[model samples]
Target: MSFRPVIISLVVLALAGLALAFAPTGTTARPDQGDARPFQLRDTEGNLVTDTSLRGQVVLLYFGYTFCPDVCPTELGYVARVLRAMGDDVERTTPLFVTVDPERDTPELLKGYAPLFHPRIRALTGTPEELAAVFKTFGVTARKVPGAGSHYLMDHSSSITVLDRQGRVAATIGSTDTIARSVTTLRDILGKP
Candidate 1:
């Protein structure tokens, strides 16, 4: 028994070391832009959606939970600020809010939450499997933790993904930047085509 425990500890340490050695060392990892595969996700209306649904526009995707105490609200506010700065020019941009905590964030909940931001913004949720698939494709990681009873809180990447008219990820905007820069960057991308 002692020998087995010792061996297990060594194996665990080795695995940890390997993980640290190979782990990515940045806030965002660039995806192969050439691999512009389309993805399907549901909107707050429970309607089926696809990447093409966002054609002829610049799409901003933010993965977060409504229950998020601080980050979600702040980021959404930033998005709102950016939109406000754009004024009428914001028509060509679409902002999507994907809830990482789907168990509690239903379509009805999103209906109430999404409108709190700019009118152009929308919120979406799907089954765990559906969300997992989309998250993986977007390289977003999320998890739910116990809180009280069946209730839980979620953690996810705060980075926002910006997709061009071609439905390809053109650039990523993190939470670190000011709303002004974010709006400028988005407008610059929209000006391209």
Candidate 2:
């Protein structure tokens, strides 16, 4: 049993496992092309937003509450950095801050908080029903937990779901740990020749 042969066999097995685990699900075609899922939600101004409105743009959908003490802002800050890296490319992209705490985050509240991160970012909130539908559609979950007074913590999926030009979910950026990965993912998805 030569050590070289054993090592080579192990390496080949590992490579095969990696390939199977990461193989494209074919659920999302290349970012450059594909039919994306249609997404519709209300802007902070209460205007109805349709999926067609996001055409030819890379959209990052972040689900969090404005009252969030840290995670939300940190994630948004990373998004700001990514946008800055993009520079003019930001024109073709948008960061959307969708509120999980609609009770306290109204259209006006969102409007005030979102722009603090970036000029291109837009915040949105809607009725609980509307938010629930959107969350379900995107596979993000949000639940309210009891808290002090009228305040409560919302347990939501802390992942930034990236939507390609066609409004399909291209990838997910999880928590703050994936900021660098997100920047790379965005740059790669933007595909700026």
Candidate 3:
């Protein structure tokens, strides 16, 4: 008749529920296995960028906003390093920076921000409704965190979604993955050494 065991079981169950609630969406699919959800958004030049338009190239897609103080820049820096390390092989790759905060991350601002990391990175944004569809397609979650009046921060997921030549998800690099790891993943997808 010990209630200790029952209390421990309840606590464990609670913890499991919490973990499930906060877990990120999306399944990690192996190379060339899962079909990437299609999307269309506008690039910095007001050009419509779509999944179908990038069929023959490998894509490195990252989601974040220009105003992100640290994490976004760090992740983008890693992406730039990976591109540089690719050498001539970079020509076959397309690096994309998709803004999760379209309200503030206009194409004009993104045009300035993206090239600061690398000349090849194309920044994109779209209408809020359009962005929401793309976000769901990529299993990206973004929320606005209220800060001081008239200013706020966005809380969002950080990860790189790698797509192969066929526009299918080849791999998903975690936020903590190193540049070397990211390069390796890209190479594997690109079938390069």
> For this target, which candidate reaches the highest lDDT against the unseen true structure?
3
List ranges where model 2 is wrong by over 4 Å: 1-35, 174-180
Candidate no. 1 TM-score:
0.84
Quote each prediction's TM-score. 0.84, 0.76, 0.85
Where does model 3 exceed 4 Å of error? 1-32
For model 2 the local lDDT of residue 191 reads: 82
> Candidate 2: deviation at residue 138, Å?
1.2
Clashing pairs in 2: none
In model 2, the Cα lDDT at residue 115 comes to: 89
lDDT tens digits by residue: candidate 1, 145-188: 78898778876788888888878887788668977788888888
Write out the backbone clash pairs for model 3.
Answer: none
For each candidate in the order shown, give its overall lDDT on alpha carbons: 0.83, 0.78, 0.86
The TM-score between candidate 2 and the true structure equals 0.76
The TM-score ranking, best first, is 3, 1, 2
lDDT of 2 by residue, 1-193 (tens): 6799999999999999999998633212323334566667899777987678877789888899987888899889878887887767788888899898988888888888998989889998777787777877676667788889977887766767788776777777645555567677887877832
Candidate 3's error at 61, in angstroms? 0.5
